[model samples]
Target: MSLKKLISIFFLISNFIFALEIQPTMFEQRIDGSGGYREFIVSNNTNSTLRYKLTIFPGSKKDRDMSKWTEVSPKILTIKPGRNGIFKIFVQTPKEISDGEYDYTLSLKTMDLPKLPGETDKIASAAKLNFDFRLNFIGYAGDLNPDIDFINPVVSTNANGKTVISGTIVNKTPKRGIYCAVNVISGENSLNYSEIRVPVNGEKQFSVTLEPNVKKSDITGITIRNLENSDIILKKPI
Candidate 1:
């Protein structure tokens, strides 16, 4: 997809009732000899004290579990109102691991501010909007894979009120997951395009959004391909 087409696909409308501000929504890089460490800054703006818990999830259950190789310092932390804190995460490379790209999700979830220690808050407060933030990790261990399969695509509106071509993407490759652009088509004309990725040997639901100007009735197909090689990986009519 061209730069113009790429920008058109991610026309997102965010209605975030936010409380905690986290920086660097996603991380993509290679792990150096020192360690592949990342730091995220969190700012608590709400009146209540917020506790964030850090957890890592593997991209695909079918592939090797790399979640165990990650280290998150201060797995759970408490930040008072108007205070800022940081969470550091780094990869602890395992022995004899495959030199390829690895995919994982780092999630930060907020816990309730109880009135007392070791006590649960029974009363719900709507003013404090608890949130779960998912930060994507696309770490290049050394290299990666390019296999992808698009399945069962259909037109739907996402939670953010965007029109999208929803479907499943399967990374059937044994060692590496892929991140790439998806082209939505109405016959030969490219309707719009969006990005998607699946963990190595794992499947994930995808929503390749149609640009606001495109009519839903006109969408007829989905395309996944290698732009560099002009290779069509999968092209299916919805």
Candidate 2:
């Protein structure tokens, strides 16, 4: 199909919104009551004027809303064609807050333009588009590290007639959630690989299928690697 359609499909699968390009879609750092801030840029690539708005939503419980301690300056912005706008994010931890991880979803939406008069009667109207640009915000309270453990793992054939390895991976730390990658090995070769996220003090189910060329009997085990440093978190033998 068209190149634009292909890009849209890829972005949809990756859970990303294609809009005015923004740098640093994720923010993760150590925060305290003293307050800290970060600055990012919004690049306008189109010929028309770009107007974007940012909103922070709670990703946790009502009592754990992180929006209370966070501030995004100039939430609404307008940039000329082919220009960039900079915005700063400031956050502060409360003294009464417990030592742990906090997170929120920051969404960016492009404002719609007003409809022109007498345009639709003679010609097709321009489609008004709205994009949900989600930015992940993660803040850590105190000293913390990622600790992921593989529970029980087993191999079996899935309904699609493919060799599947399934099990549970738990985050043993009370610090914060972690993004990790897992490599499934068979004998001396890597059969499959995938990325996963484990919530703080929570567990997530993982199911990965081996390559078609893999021999099931030679399956060795799995290795969990840190996405940031690529450190071997754990090696589980089955």
Candidate no. 2 TM-score: 0.61
Which residue pairs in model 1 clash with each other? none
Per-candidate Cα lDDT values, in order, are 0.65, 0.71
TM-score of each: 0.46, 0.61
lDDT of 1 by residue, 11-41 (tens): 2112223555776544444453454777778
Span of ten consecutive residues with least summed lDDT in model 1: 8-17
For model 2, residues 11-72, the per-residue Cα lDDT tens digits are 54343233357755455555666765677899865445556787777756565557777888
Q: Residue 88 lDDT in model 2?
A: 81
Instruction: Please report the TM-score between candidate 1 and the true structure.
Output: 0.46
Worst 10 residues of 2 by lDDT: 119-128
